[model samples]
Structure formats: C-alpha cells, structure tokens
Target chain A: MKYTEEHEWLRIEGDSVVVGITEHAAEQLGDVVFVELPEIEAVVAKGDEVCVIESVKAASDILAPVDGEITEVNEALTDNPGLVNEDPQGDAWFFKMKLDDLSVLDDLMTEDEYKDFLG
Target chain B: MSDTLRRTPLYDLHTELGGKIVPFAGYAMPVQYPMGVMGEHTHTRSHAGLFDVSHMGQVILRGPDAALALERLVPVDVAGLAEGRQRYAMFTNDKGGILDDLMVANRGDHLFLVVNAACKAADIAHMRAHLPELEVREITDRALLALQGPGAEAALNALLPGVADMRFMDVATFDWQGHALWVSRSGYTGEDGYEISVPDAQATAFARALLAQPDVAPIGLGARDSLRLEAGLCLYGHDITEMTSPVMAGLQWAIQKARRAGGAREGGFPGAERILQELADGPLAIRVGLRPEGRAPMREGTVLWDAPEGGRNLGGVTSGGFGPSIGAPIAMGYIPTTSAQPGTRLWGEVRGKRLPVTVCDLPFRPSTYKR
Candidate 1:
C-alpha cells in the first residue's frame, strides 16, 4: 500500500492499483453526500483531477495519483455516498487504475511515512 | 485563529462541548460540533437546537421619535408595529439595494434591533448618522441564543415557564432566576423557536440549563445556515446584497401595505422611487428556489443558463447546499422574471458541465412555524 500527500491511498492489485481517499481525509470532510466518478477506460495523467466528492459542507476533488487509465469505479457510491465516510479505505475505494509501470508506486509514501507526514 | 478575532460569551461552552471552532464574520465561532453538520441539521429539524448568535449586533433605539426615525431607513411599518411584536426589515441603499436585513422588536419605550454580525458596525454607523434624534446604543454586554425546532417550545418552557404562551413573532421580557431575559418567539430556521438575549454573566449557565433537557443540543453555524436555506431565508452577504433590491429578492411581503405606493407612510425610505416602481411594475430579475436533478450539489457561484447546450447566461447561485431534512440538494439564485415560474427548467453550470435544474417555489421544505 502507498499514500499520496493529497490524502489518497493506493493499493497494488494484480496488474492495477486501487485508489481511494484516506480515513483522515474522510473524517475531515464530515458527511459525504455525493460523488462524481470518472468514466471507465478514460486515460488520465498523474495529478489530473478525475473525481469530485461533495460533503454536506463543501466539495473536494480527487486527483489521479499516477499516470494510468481508469479501469473500474465503485458504482455503489452513486446510490450511497455515505460509504465514503463509513469505509473510506475498504469497500469505498473510488476507482481502480491500470498503470504502465507499477514500480512508480515505490516513490510514494509508505504507511509509516504517511503516518509521520500526518503528524 | 487570529488574535484579532473576537469571542462570544459561549466560546468556553462551545469548546467544552467539542465544537470545531472556525472563523466567521470576524469571530472565532464554531462551524460544527462532534455531531457533524448533517447530524446537527437533522437534529434541529426533529428536536431543539441551541445556537450561540452573540456575534450578531443588538441595538436599542430610544426616544419618542425612534419608530418614526427608523421608518425613514427601512421600507417597513415600524411606527405601526405593536408594542410586543417584532417585524423583519432591511436597510436599503440609495440605489434600491439592500444594505442589511434585520429584526426590529417594539420593546415598549425603545425599539430593539438585531442586525447581522458582519454588517453590525456599518449598520450602527448608518443608524447613528441618519437618525440623530434617537439614542442608538449597541448592547455589547449581552449574548443572543436561538433555540429552534419543533421541540423548542417544550424545551424552553421547561426552563422558562411562560415562553410557551408567546406566539410567533411575539417579544417579551421574562425573569429567569433574577436575570432579565429578553426573548422573541422568532428564528431563522422556519421552526417554532425563541431567540433569547441573556446577560453575558448568565449566558453560559442559561445555555447549560437548556442543554440539560433531552431535546436540546448545542448546534453550530453549519446547521444554522442549512436550516435557513431550507426555509427560503436570504443570507446577509449572499442572497440579499447591496446590489439586489427587496422586490428582486422576493422580499416584497416584508413591505407592509402602509409603506406601499398609495399608503399612508409611503415614499419616505431610501431608494423609495425604485422600490415603489418595482412593487407596481414588478422587478426585472427575481430570486427563485432551485433543485438539482441528481445527487451532485450545485453550489454557490454556479452559473445558470437558459439552455443546456448554448443559451443566454443568467445570474449565478447565491446560496446552495445539500439539505439534510429535504434529503436532496437545494439552492436559491436570481433569474429573469420570465423564467421564474415554479416548474420552469434551467441549467446550472457546475464544473464546466450544464446540469438539469428546476425552478421551484421559495422554500424547498414547508415551514413549521407555530403560528
């Protein structure tokens, strides 16, 4: 598992990485009311804003962690946005992306480094 | 938080209740508590919620000419208001724009005014400069608290015996344990509620006693805003601005018949020409309630268009948010009178994409005021 400074967490799957917001980010956002997901098979570069998360208070954007094509998105969030607040890192994973080189994840922060960064 | 920011008398109590303090209107006020904005909003709809509104300015206008002098500034019947009743009013600019919205209560020999926190300093200056015959004294030694919801009367009446007898928009002075509490049966949430003005020394204890009841919870500004939005209320700096006239903002009802074109006290306020003309011929642009089609919330500053693809650009949204009680996204914005029909279709441009939105009536939810 790897983390980005923007409070996104990425976990390596078979040939793709699952991206979702961290628990810390979800807590800061309070209650999640709506989520606008990126379309499947959409090509995106690193740092590209692909998703939008709306809370009761404000709206936030989710950026593509690394260069990849979106493979699948969590359709469950469309019916129930509260999943992002309930299980932000687990069942609430936003989308899965196929990266050309999985080794790029090595440059991102680890669990220990992310915890220290939060401090 | 900056050191220059002011603190309300309930600041210590809010911190003690785990409130998340944030800067609002030059004050370090609580935006939400541990209950969160959604929970607090829903709770306020179902039960009583207490809000520390001490940041708002409270002023008293004395002398025999106070009511008549105040009538010159606002387009309302201040002189005709009864002794124990309060009326909603606004300070209009020379260009027919709204300076600020306020509540004026006829407190026997004096008129009690409650203005917005951000506009209080300028409002006091404006009142002093215009109504020189009246003594304008700002009450800085008291704190204002709003207890709003369907359960508000029961909760407040448990502590203060006679609050249940006061009807909506009624104002009275009650004695609670030797404290002269100035209370009004009015609130911004469109619910049966009371706005209690207590001395600073007794505010914390009074709030604590109210919170002791099961139906009362300490709400914050986040819920206060969402509640007012659902009630079709205009926010000070947003919906009603220095550029939006009363008729344009759909606040013509606040202007009584006595202040109209052919009435007894007509044409004395600032910008009376434009306001009276708009009242007769109708405003060019008017404010309307809007509901988005999907779950995505169309927030403030989202531009409106006449068509989805290519059309004329209308005005932007003034106040927009996800209404917890209504269980959907709601908004209010200005648009052309031709397109202000209740069921008219419009498009709100959110993040470069035009989404479907329907023009609805003023309030998204029905007001449950105890009339």
Candidate 2:
C-alpha cells in the first residue's frame, strides 16, 4: 500500500493501482455527500487533482499519487456517497488507474511512514 | 506562548464527550462531536440536538421606556410586540445597511435580547448609546442552550411540564431545579424547538441531564451552520453583513405593518425612509436561493453570471453547502432584481468550471415550525 501526503492511498495489483482516500481523510471530512471522479482514459500526473470528495463541511480534492491513466471509476458512489465514509479502504475504492511508470510507486510513503507523518 | 482562547461553561463537558474544538467569535467552541457533522445534523432534524450557544450575547433591557427607546434603533414594531412574544429584528445603520440581526423577546417587565456572538459588543454598544436612559445590562452570568428538533418538546417536558403548551415565538420563565430558566419556543433550524437560558453554574449539569434523555445528543457548531443554512436562515457575517440592507436581504417581512408607511407608528426608526422606499420600489439587489444543476456544491464567493459562457456579473454566492435533510446541495446569494424571480437561469463559476444554476425561492426546504 502507498499513501500520499494529501491523504490518498493506492494499492498495486498487476499493471494497475486501486485508489481511495485514507480513513483519516474520511473522518476529517464529516459526511461524504458527493464524489466527483475523473473520466476514464484521462491522463493524470502525480499531485494532480483527479477527483473531488464533498462532505457536509466542505469540498476537498483527491490528488493522484502517481502518473497514470484512469481505467475505472466507482459508479456506486454516485448513488451512495456514504460508502466512502463507511468503508474508505475496501469497497469504497474511488478509482483504478493503469500506471504509466512503475518507478513512481517507490516514491510514495509506506503505511508506517504515513502514520508517523499524520502524527 | 500565546493567549488561550476563552472557554464556555460546557468546555469540560465538550472535551469529555469527544468534541472537536475550534476557535469561533473569540471563543473555543465545539465544531463537531464523535457522531460527526452528518450524524449530528440528521439527529437534530429527526430527534433532538442540544447546542452550547453560550457564546451568543444575552442582554436584558429594563426601563419604563425600553420598548419606545428600542423602536428608534430597530425597524420592528417594538411598541406593538405583545408581552411574552418574540420578534426577529435587525439593527440598521444610517445608510440603511444592516449592523446586526437579532431576536427580541418581550418578557413583560424587561426585554430579553439575543444577538450574535461576533456582533455582541457592537450591538450592545449601539443599544446603550441609543437608549441612554434605558437600562441595557449584558447578562454574562448565564449560559444559553438550544434544544431543537421534533423530539425537543417531549424530551424537555419530561423534566419541566407545560413547556409544550407555549406557542411558537412564545417566551416564558420556568423553574428548573430551583433555578430560573428562561425559554423561548423558537429556533433557527425552522423546527419547533426551544432556546433555554440557564444559569452558568447549572449549565454543565443541565446539559448532561439533557443528553441523558433518549433523543438528545450534543450537536456542535458545524451541524448548526448546516442546519440553519438548510432552513434558509441568514448568518450574520456571511449572508447579511454590514454592507447589506434588510430589504435587500429579503427580511422586510420582519418589519411589522405598523413600522412601515401609513401605520400607527409610521417611519420612526433609523433608515425608515430608505427602507420604506425600497419596500414601495424594489431594491437594487435581492437575496435569493440558487440551485446548481449537478451534484457539485458551490461555496461562498463563487461568481454568478447571467449566461453560461460569460455575461454580466450579477452577484456572488454568500452561503452554500450540502443540505443533509434535503439530500441535495443548496445555496443562497444576492442577485440583480431583474433575475431574482424563481426559475430564472444563471451560471455559477466554480473551480473554473461554469455550472448551470437556477434561481429559486428562499428556503430550500419547507419549515416545520408549529405556528
């Protein structure tokens, strides 16, 4: 698992990575009411705002952790956005992207490193 | 290293209940609790939510000429306000701008006034200056709590009976555990609820007692703002500021008929001429409700234009957020008088994207107040 400073997390699976926000980010954003995702086949770079997660408090950007092309977007979140708050890590995965360069994954923080960074 | 923020009487209770503290209006207030903003907001709409509103200013106006003196400052019919009734009013400046909006409750012997925390100092000073002979005493020895929702009356009446008998906007004094408790059957959420003024010494215990009830939970300021916004109520600094007028803010209904032209007490208040003129002829800009086309919610300062691509800049969104009860994103803002009617089409520039929006009526949701 890889995490970005912006509180987004990614998991590698074959040639693509599954993306979603961390539990901490989900908790910080009170209630998840709406989620705006990037279109499939859209190319995104690291630190680019590829999606938006809106809560009752405010709307926050979900930045891409690595350069990739969007492969799949979570269609279920359109009807039930609260899934992101309920299971931020598992079923609530925001999107999947095919990686352009595999070396960028090593630049992201590990799980333990992200914990310390949060503290 | 730095001065600490002021704490209310429920500060310890808030921390113990896992409330997230934030600085607001010079006081450290709880923005949300462990239940989160969404939970608190839904609970307030369904059951009941107890709010620690101690930071708001509570004042007592006493004197034989208090009502007459107050009418000179506010544009409301203070002289006609029946005893034990509450009236929504605002302090207008010389140029017809709103200084602060407030609630005035006539308690027979004295007037109980509640003003916003940020504008409390200025409101009190303005009142004192205008009514020099009248006694304007700021009551700091009390803590205010609002028990609001559909279950509010049942939960409150379990301890103090007959509170449910009071009509909307009714104010009365009751004895709670041998202490004088002032309660008004009114709230900002457009729900039937009560705003209780309790002694500071018993505030913590009283709050805890309310939480022990079946339907009461400790809601924080975050949910409070969302709830009020969904109810289409105005926030002082955001919606109606010193630069906005009561007429432009769409609060002219608050001015009683007697306070307007050709009434018993006609045009005796500040900015009366301008307010009456605007009443006869519409104002330059008016506050209206804006409903965005899609799911994305617009925030304050989002530039509104007449056309989708680019047109004349009409106005900007003042307050916008997701309304939990309505299950959609809603907003309120000021637009030109020409496009203020409901169903008028407009476009909002949000995050560099031009989103289509429709001009709708105020109050995204219907009020459930028991009138």
Candidate 3:
C-alpha cells in the first residue's frame, strides 16, 4: 500500500523495512532477470544511485529514496531475480535501509495516487 | 500494445511470475523483470539462469539425401558433420553474403536445424527454393528454454540424468516427464548449460519442474544479450548482416577447410567472389573488438574516429555495452583492416564527445563451457 515517486515501496517490518520495486516500475522495466543490490553498510543519500535493475532493452538504477545506511540486501536476488517481477511490492524487496528522515516517505505518492499518476 | 499477440507456451507462467513481456523476434517475450539484467547475468554466470526461447525456429529437414541436398544451399562441410555433432554455420547467397547463421545437427538421416525466430520464414523459403526435393517441417509448435551458467549442468542433471554427459556442441534426445525433447549442451551465454527444445504442450510442465530446483529461476532476454555480449557473440542484425561477409567479421574459422579448399568460398554461394578475395587479400574493413573509456554506454551506431589530427571516421559501433565480467564498457565495430590490431587506440564518438577506445581481443570474458 506504500509507494514512492521513484516507483519503490517500503513495507514496514518491525524496526527494519523491506523495500521492493513498484508494480509500475516493474511493468515499465519489462521482464527483469537480474538485480544488482548495494552492499551492506553502504551509506546512501537521497536520490543517490544505490542499486541497478536490468530489463531487456535498458538497465535502470534504483535510486535511494532517502539518506540512510544499507543494513541488509536481498541475497536471494542473485539466484532468483525474477522475484521482483513476481511481486514488485511483495517478494521483490531489494534491501532494507534505515531512513535518514522518515519524512521522505511523505513526499512519495501513495499506491492509489501512483496508479492514477500514470494516467 | 495490442492483446492480439502470440504467446509462448510459458506465457501464463511469465505473467504469474511478473515478467515484463515485450515484442521480440515476432513473439511477446519477457525482456526483463524487476531484478534487471545485470543481476540476472551475474547470477546465471555464477549459477543457473532459465530462458524461454520458443521464438527460435526448431526445424527438421528430411529427404532421401538430405545432407547432399542441403550442401547446395550453405557452407559447413555438411557431409562430414557427425550424426550428433552440432555445428555453428551460415547460409550464404550466390554472391557470398551471409543470409543467416544457424546451428545444424545431423540427426541420423535427417538434419535438425535451430534458427533465429525473426528469420524463420525467410530461411525456410530460401531453403525450399534451393532444395525443393527435401521436406522441411517447422516445429514451431515446440518451445525451447536455455538453462545457462556455471551450475546449469548440475541443475539440469538433477531432473534428467546422463544429460550432463553431453559436452559442448553435443545433443541428445531425452524424455522429460513423458514429453520427449531434443536437449543440446549449448547456449548463447558462454556457460556450461543446456538448451531444451520440448513439445509445446509439455513446455510448462518442464518449466515448472526446472523452477522447482533450488538453483533454477527464469531469465529474460535482457540478460541473454549482455551475457552473449560478454562472451563476444554476435547478434544477427547488429553484428552479422547480409551486407557483411563472414570473412570480414572474423568468422572465417567457422568455414571448413573442405568448403574453402573445394572452391565453395571461391564463388558458389552468393557474394563468394568478394568474400574469397577478402579472405585472400584481407578485407578493406575488419570487425574488431572495442573497449570504451568511461561508464557511459556507447551503443550501436556510435561513430568511430581515428585518434590524433587529420584522422578520418573509421567505422561505427555495431554493438556496445557495460560488461559485468570486464567491469567496464565494451563494443565491437568495423574498422580499416590495417588498423585492426589488438591494443590499437581509437575514438568512439558518443553524443559528439570523443571517448578514448582501444582494440581488444574477441570476447571480454573467457567462456567456461566445456568446449
């Protein structure tokens, strides 16, 4: 239900957060086969290039939604990258980042809003 | 896009798994997923990567003397090809230009051919016109999936034993959950893997079975391109085209001695005269490997320039990309044969900026396949 203008979503999990690509971003990317995630402990800033997602025609960078430190990465991505395509908002979580400013989420679009924005 | 589209047998599975399907080679195929190509390419190189390649044409050529009949159309020393040995070869026109490249295997009396999906119909027509006596059957009803990577052999062997015994350029008929298929130890990715060509009706079941394996997952065409690029393989339209000859492309090695010494490369096939002369005196332009200076990609059509003053535009990049293996950007293009040497410095014009480039050896990554 949560969303970002960059087409990523953060589903809360206790103190940590699970992030995945938005369905819109996944649809735009076509079929994704490989996902490159940032290493753990890698510090990232808002809008910084944190990771990469590759589709057939183009390889896109997944920008950081907020300045924070990468606490964990989805190791499964190396073996099963198509998970992002399966459930962009669910199983395709790329990494977990502690928010530098939780307020950044407020600037992001909601799931409903993002769906309409595409129109 | 219109819903009036042709779907591969794995269509439903692709949608369920969230594959981003796109039109390619006349079929709606998964180009990428959310994870992307770079990760997928690396994963497949390190592990196993699945690919639905049903779009490629799987054909069977049958006739009283199919080998003799096919020899009139292409050059690959077809007569000497063993029954189960696969060959990477080309179909040439009367003048020696390549019509298309294909994998031809002698399956006993008949020939089993795997061709590019985009050129299937034209290839069939060309073959028919040249060898009318032979019967060509399009097994388009079948679907193919390429399982490539370092761990590919073990993953496939789990389901079908004895499959791992086949070496590169080898093929064998196997039974998959009651469906028979022609599985080849071959792939576009320079990995030890298998290309399973199975009946369409059983493609989904086979795909499901493979997915059940812990190390297996579906890969899209996106990774396929990058991996092949890393392996320095050529794409049909971009690298090898009808306008380009095999000799110029540095594919003269694929031409058998019997064909070249038998006057086949002399002029029998279309453009053979120019091609043979190019082989003798060397081509005016040669296809050479290129590595760019920076992270920015220099894709096809990026013009090449001779370095220093008074330099001329030598050629254009036919294919370029950031290779995960090389950890840098790479490309290939046609340059003056005189300047086509390893370590030769050149320039690649990207958005009008001249980036320093250098000629490297073919293939940015060493192939790990058991060739």
Candidate 3 lDDT at B37 equals 70
Which regions in candidate 3 have their CA more than 4 angstroms from the true location? A1-56, A59-115, B262-267, B308-310
Q: Candidate 1 docking: what grade? A: high
Q: DockQ winner between 2 and 3, please give it.
A: 2
| lDDT over C-alpha atoms for residue B234 of model 3 | 84
Each candidate's lDDT (Cα)?
A: 0.95, 0.91, 0.81
> How big is the positional error of residue B200 in model 3, measured in Å on the Cα after superposition?
0.7
What is the DockQ for all candidates, taken in turn? Answer: 0.95, 0.80, 0.12
**Model 2 lDDT tens row, B1-371:** 11477788999999999999999999999999999998899999999999999999999999987888899988999888999999999999887888999999999999999999999999999988989988999999999999999999999998778899999999999998999999999988877899999999999998998899999999999999989998889999999987888999999999889888888888777788889999889899999999988888888899999988857899999999888887888899999898898999899998888898899987887777878
Point out the worst 10-residue segment of candidate 1 chain B by lDDT: B362-371
lDDT of 2 at B165: 96
Q: Tell me the deviation in Å of residue A46 in model 2.
A: 1.9
Candidate 3 lDDT by residue in tens digits, B1-371:
45766789998998888787888876899876555676777888888999998988888999988876777777667777888888888887766677888999888878999999888899999888888999999886899899998888888998899888998989888877777888888899888899999888988988988888888878888789988988888898889888788888888887677667454333355566676677778888878889876555667898888974458999999988767667667888899888888998988886556878998888888898787
Q: Mind giving the per-residue lDDT tens digits that candidate 2 earns over A64-86?
A: 88888999999998888999999
- The better-scoring model by DockQ among 1 and 2 is 1
C-alpha RMSD between model 1 and the true structure:
0.9
